[model samples]
Structures are given as structure tokens and as C-alpha cells.
Target: MEVDLGEPQMLAIGQLADRTGLSVSAIRFYEARGLVTALRNRGGQRRFLRSEIRRLSFILIAQQLGFTLGQIREQLAALPQGRAPTQQDWARISRSFRNSLDERIDGLVRLRDRLDGCIGCGCLSLRKCALYNPDDRLGRLGPGPRLLLGDAPSEPAISPAAAIGSS
Candidate 1:
């Protein structure tokens, strides 16, 4: 259902949970984490704006996409508070989020391409492992598959000819 933004529609905590498909505890947790806000009614009951449904939905989607709570919070911070976000507001945040997702997708593709070969596995078993970290030399570059983690080698670690010959 489309929310009438001009209406002063307030949802009880239970209603908000029902609308967002989130458990009451989960909604409270998100509220505590600053992802959502709740206002106290005259009876001291928590109330949420109808717009919170969209915010909670976005949170769920972002989490599914592997965004951390902090990252999701940063994105949601772009949205207006205490009011329904306008289309332009959502558009701006989505454009920023799309860039992040695109970068992650590119990294995944690069990882897939390298999976057939060494992938900076640090095994040093291959004759010409591009990320040959013999004796853990790349350990100085930090932990876990430095090359695969986007660390650059001082020189071209493997020539195109060598990479082809290895396969």
C-alpha cells in the first residue's frame, strides 16, 4: 500500500514490525542501533512513522547484499529524518550504493578469473604462481592473499607469456 505522506500516520511498534516483516525485538534492536527511531506516544508506547517501513526494508536488502550495519547506517543517514524520503532523496542514496555494489561485483569477477590459477593462495606450489609469496614474503603486505586482496606488487609479478605457459 502506498503511504500517504501528508497524513500524520503513526504506527505502533507491533504494527511497524508487522509491516516490515521484522520481529519486534529486531525492530527494537535496529532502533537502538540508530537505524530507526521511535517516538513515545501519550501512553508512553513506541510509535514509528509509516516511512520507517521503507527504511527497514532497505536495511534488510542492504544486509543481504553483505553490507555491515555501519555501512547501512551510513547510507540511511542520507535519508531525511522524521519524514518520508522524496524520490530524489532515494535516488541520491541509491546512486551512491550502486557504485559500491559495482565495485564489489568487479572484485568478485576478478576473483573468479584468478580462481583457475594461484589466486595468491600463498602455497608457492605452482612453477610460476603470479602471487608467489615464497617464505611468506608478502606477509609483510598484511594477512590473507595479499594480491587477491588488491595489494599491488612492486613489479609485474607474472608476464602474460608466463601466465599462459603455466596453464
Candidate 2:
């Protein structure tokens, strides 16, 4: 039951499950998917290297970032067994995820800017706003904002002169 920390040790399935906070079934699933590999005992039970703990942790973190199992596998493929991941390997993976995170942040910023513009414009109806009618040709387009908001139609446009001095 005592693990020797001085040497490279192999752990049983139960111990690995406990150490990784993963169910035995889930560990087996990872093994089957080639995300983690284990050696077979003479009795055919699986034995995992202690390093698998770190690998499993990485897998969980990658999954949280919305990477598919296949994508994680592809990223991890660059790492070899019996050696820690090199700086180059880490950089490559980091670059891939960084690009994805940057894209998500850009989209959120764009959405926030659009919402801020709507607030400043005092336009409750998205369909009838000037921001929605970028080209000012919604009438010819037949029922909808053609350029900006591009959602649904609003009330018909009234002439500016008619409403200028009216109470």
C-alpha cells in the first residue's frame, strides 16, 4: 500500500483512480481511447505509471477549455513517454489554445461594443434603429434591416419633415 516516491513506480487501477480523482471506469475509458496507456500484469490487470496522474490532470484541463478528445490526443501526441514535455511542445500546444481563446475574447468584446452602442442610441427596438439600418435602404430590401441589425422589420418610416415641428 506504500508508494516509494524515490523510484519510478507503477500503480494499480484503484490507486490511480484515487490519485487522479477519476472513477475506475473513466480511467479505463481514457486507456481505451489512447489518452492514457497502461501495462498489463500477468493476471491481465492494468498497471499505470505514476506519471499518468499528471497526464490525466492535463486531459481534464484541456477538456474544460472545450477541446475535443481527438484534439487533446493530437496535442498530446507530440510528447514522448519516459520524458517530460519539452518547452517547444508546450509552446506549440499553448499557441493553439491561445488562438482559440483570443478568438472567443474578440467575439465577446464585439458583442459588448454592440450592446453599448444600442444603449447610447436609446433604441429599445433593434429592428428600427439607425444602427440596424446602416445602408438606409431597408424599404427596397423588403422587410428587414439589410446591413447592421438585420433581424426583423419595424414600423414604416415616417418623413423627417412631417414629425419635425409636430407636437
TM for every model, in the order presented, reads 0.73, 0.59
lDDT values for all models:
0.82, 0.68
Candidate 2 stretches with Cα past 4 Å from truth are 1-6, 82-92, 108-167
lDDT of 2 at 93: 73
Give me the displacement of residue 57 in model 2, in angstroms: 1.4
Q: After superposition, how far is residue 142 of candidate 1 from its true place, in Å?
A: 5.4
lDDT of 1 by residue, 25-80 (tens): 99999999999999998999999988899999999988987999999999999998
- Return the TM-score for candidate 1, rounded to 2 decimals: 0.73
lDDT of 2 by residue, 50-155 (tens): 8788788889887876779998898778667664455676788778778777866665565665553332223335543444333343555553323233333355
- The whole-model C-alpha lDDT of candidate 2 against the native structure comes to 0.68
Q: Assess the local accuracy of residue 129 in candidate 2 as a C-alpha lDDT between 0 and 100.
A: 47
